[model samples]
Each structure stands twice: as structure tokens, then as C-alpha cells.
Target: MAEKELLRISNLVASFSINGGYYAAVDGVSLQINENEVFAIVGESGCGKSALALSILNLHNKANTKIEGSIYFKGRDILSLGLEELNKIRGRDIGMIFQDPLTALNPLMIIGAQIEESLFYHTGMNIGERKKRSLELLTQVGIQSPELTYHQFPHELSGGMRQRAMIAIALSCKPSLVIADEPTTALDVTIQAQILDLLRRLQKEMKSGIILITHDLGVVAEMADRVAVMYAGQIVETADVNEIFSNPLHPYTKSLFASMPDAYRNARKDQRLPVIEGMVPSLLNMERRGCRFAPRIPWISDAAHEAVPQYHEVKPGHLVLCSCYKNFYLKSIPRRVSSSTLR
Candidate 1:
């Protein structure tokens, strides 16, 4: 069975002006999310994951930030739409779960008012109805004492409670697609599990497509239906969640798996935990040739890297960037790993 396509992005480039010159934060990226599925974008800290999420809704400052390319949601090119038109869809059709609840939520505003703002703006709900819906939303997101929570300010809540409040606000209008940018970031292990489980349950209940952005492969393994691995500003690999865990093709992807903690490791044990050598290259003044991950993979021959790396689909629904996979080895060791040995 095939899932319905909810959102599609193509050649999307989001650039910020620095020293009167523009640098691509998200460069030539393309991906899609489908209904009733969780599609995750995983990468290191500086890999433009959040930029890609924000670019989908044109959420950048017009003064310094420029976005180009098409974002098609529900068969419409939302990128070309005006602010008035986009506003109608922003909270009504699509919801965004920001990374930091403290910063995202207003300090002066009460929780119920924040949730009701979307309803007030997008729906034709009266004041009485809005308050009732807001209380129900708080309860649905696992918050105890809905009435008390509604009147409380963001400062009065714990980190986990604040996150649940953010979730409540996001799902207030039952959006068709939800973009959760590191929804569980800063919470304890127990709270993280609870939040992820809550998200999964709400997604199923609302039947919404989810684009979960995070650096946690463990979370991806537990929640994602498909995953796209980003390096620098480009997608280095993408595949079904099981395919990624079972047989990681891209060297960057393999390195990420190798560096996982014991709890996230998949039977690949060793005396020392693996770490990918070298740091991620600066996004500014990027190398205009070869693989973006080539600097960190000096052991692999230059011949294995393409001048302009492109995704090559070697299997059904599996795409790997460039030929760097051929000569990929760990921790400065030079070994040609054949696809047969990949198993």
C-alpha cells in the first residue's frame, strides 16, 4: 500500500547574507513527507537540519535571509503564496513544534491564550468554545489539571511540562503535517521517551505526516518510517528506517552509526566506542568540489569522490551520495568494503 504525499520540496535553497555575501544554509535539498508516516532528517549539529525545517514555511527574516525553490503542500506551491494566503495554512493546515519551548512561547501570555490564538485567527470558534478546546488540548497532551495549566504562564511549568504544552499548541488545530524540530532535546531520558511516545500516539490519532529533525539515531530507529541523512547542507543518504539501520551505505551514515552509545549500538561492539575523525567543515566558504564529507574521510581515495556529488540509487528507495562508499573505512584505516561485505 502507498501512503498519500502531504508535502514535497525541490531544489530548496535557504541562504543568509554575511559580509554582503550569501551562504547557503540549506543547499539544493529535496524531500517529501507522506501521510501517516514519520520521516526523519538526521545529521550533526551544523548540518542545516533546522534551517530546512524553517525554510518549508518561509520562516526566515526577509532582511538578511533569502529562500528560493518550490515547497508544494497539498498540490499547491506554497512558496509562491502571499503572506495572507500562507497565514491561512500555517497554523490551520501545518503546525510547527519549535526546538525550545521557553523561547517559542511568550512569557507574558498564559498557556491557554497562546493555544487559543491559533483558533481565534484560523477558526471561527467563539471565545467560550476556544477556552474549552484549549483545556481539552492540555489534557490530551498528558498535562494534569487542565484548568490550572491553562491559566499558568510558561515559567510556572517544568521543562517536560513546557514541551507538552508546546505539543498541545501545535496540535490545537489538528494540522495535516507537523514539523517537530528536536521535540525531545533537553529533557531527561524518561521524559524523552514519554514525549516521543506522546508524539507517536498523537500522530496516529490525528493521522498527520511528521518531519522529525534530530541528531539522535536511536530516536530515528524507534520512530521514523524513513530517514534522510544530511551532511554539511546536502542530503548524503536516504532510505527506509530499517534499511538505514540494517545496511548503512554512505560512509558518513556508517560513521554516525559507529559513534552511537551502547544503548543505541546494534550489535557492533568493540573495546572503544567509535568516533568519526575530524570536525564538520565550516558552512561558509565551502569547498566547491568533491564530496562535502571528503575532508573527514582522507583515507578514501580522491578517485572515489565525484567532483559534484550526486545521489545514486543503488537499491529500491535507497539513495547514497557519490562513490565514497566504495573505499570507506573507520578511523583512518584504508579498506575497500565491497557491497557483499556490507551485510
Candidate 2:
């Protein structure tokens, strides 16, 4: 049987205009999220991961922004929807949990009231019913003393609690798709683990698709069913989480994994931590002719920089956007040294 696609984005292009020239921030990105699966977009900061998420929800600032391409949700092109229709779908069908809970939540409003507001707007519920639903949501997200927590203002809650409240509000409408942008950014390590666990549990129970946008490979390994590595506004590689971690094909993907602290520290003392030399090229100065990563490829020649390599399937479900892998063979990348080397 065919898996159901909850969200499908194709050739999405998002740009910011500065000094009369438009610079593409998210260019030609395409990916799909299946129902009941967690799809993650992983990249370093400013790699257009957040921009891609915002474009999916049509939440970008339009005065200085230009967005093009299709974002389809349940067969409807969300980009084509009217403002009124889009607004209705934003929370009711597509919930969003931003990176900072403090900024995402209203300072003056009580957390419970905020969650209740979504229920009131999306469902035909009275104040009492909304309150009941709000408390239920609070408890569902693992907040103890839901009644008390609901009445507290955003400033009254701790970072982790505030984040939990934000999750409650986002899930209030029982959205079929949740877009969590750096969901664990401000959290402590323990709290981060808890939040990721909660999200994983809720996603499984609700059978909803989740788009997790973060640079944290650990988090991706913990929660993602599939992973997309974004660089310079394009999805350079995508594969099942296991495949991505075990057999990354793209040089950029390999570089990212090699740079992970745990992976790097465990490497042999004689071996240098694999670093992709050169900073990400400025999007404004991006050349349309060759691979965006060509400038950073350590072993490739000038001839390889002449054109953008076509995305090729290197495994059953894995796709890499570079031809270098054909020459490097997936298994030839140096293996990580034993954990004993770290100590």
C-alpha cells in the first residue's frame, strides 16, 4: 500500500530582497513527509532550514520576501490558498512550535487561556468545554498539575515548562502535521531529552507527521524516521535516518557527521577531525552554474565545479546530490575510532 503524504514541498524558492537584488534563501528544495512519520531537516545555523519551514506555513514577511513553488497539504496547494483559508489551516491542521517558547507565547495571557483560545477558534466549544480541553492537553503533554499550570503566565513558568505549555497550545487543535523549529534550542540537556521524548510519544499516539528542523544530529537520530541534509538552500541529500547515519554519500553529509563532537572526539588522535574547509558561500553571491558545495569539496577538481551534479539514488531510498560519491564509494569514508580513544 502507498504511504499517505501529509505534506509535500516541490522546488520551493524563497528569497529576500536586499539593496534591489533578490537573494534566494531556499532554492529548489523538495521533500515529502508521510503521515505518522517524523521527517527532519538538519543543517548548520543559517542554512535555510528555518526559512524552509516558514515558507511551508506561509509565515514569511511578505513585504521584502518573495516565495515561489508548491507546498501541498492533503492535496491542496497551501501557497495558493487565500489568507483567510491559510490562517484557518495554520493552527487547526498544521501546528507550529517555534524555537523560543518565550517569544512564541503571549506574555500577558495565561498559558491555559492561550491553549483554550485555539480550541475556541477551531472548535464549537464553550468556555467551560475549552477549559476542560485545555487542561487535558496540558496533562497530555506531561505537565503535572495541569489546572495550576494553565493559570500561570509565561513569565511564571520555567524554560522547560514554558516549552511544554507551548507544545500544549500547538497541539490544542489536534493538528495532523506539526512543524517544530529547533524545538530544543533553549532547553537543558535533560529537559531536551524529555521534550524530544514527549514529542516522539505524542507523534506516535496521534499518528501525525512531524517536521523537525534542527542542526542537532543526536536529536535526529533519536526522533527522525527520515532525514534531509540542507545546504545553501537546497536538500543535498535525504535518506532513512539509519542509512544517513550509517552510509552518508554526499561529501557535505559526511563532513557534517564527521564534525559531530561525539564522532570527532572518538576519532584516532593521529587523524584530524574532518572539517569542510571554507564557510558557506553567501547566498547573494551564489552562482547558478555548478554545485553549491563544489567550492568546499576537498578532493574535487575544477572540472567537477563546471555543473551541478544531478541527484542520484545511491541506495534503495537514499538520494545524494553529488557525483563524488560514485568515486569515493559510500563505505570508504574513514571509520570513527573506538570510544576508548576519547578517554
lDDT against the true structure, each candidate: 0.90, 0.87
The alpha-carbon lDDT assigned to residue 78 of candidate 1 equals 95
Estimate, for each residue in 1-343, the C-alpha lDDT of model 2 and write its tens digit: 4789888899999999989989999998988889999999999887899999999989989898999989899999999999999989988999999999999999999998899888887899998899889889999999989989988999999999999999998899989999999999899999999999999999988999999999999999999999999998989899999999999888789888876678434565755556667788777787656677776765666564336668899787799886765554212345559777996
Candidate 2 has its poorest 10 consecutive residues by lDDT at 326-335
Pairs of residues clashing in candidate 1: none
lDDT (0-100) at residue 227 of candidate 2?
Answer: 97
lDDT of 1 by residue, 1-343 (tens): 6878999999999999998999898888999889988999999998999999988888888899989989999999999999999999998898999989999999999999999999999999999999999999998999989999999999999999999999998899999999999999888999999999999999999999999999988889889999999988899999999999999999999999887776533655444666777787776867746798898877788998988888899798999999889778777333447688886
TM-score of each: 0.94, 0.92
Q: Which structure among the candidates has the greatest lDDT?
A: 1
Q: Which has the greatest TM-score?
A: 1
Error of 2 at 332 (Å): 15
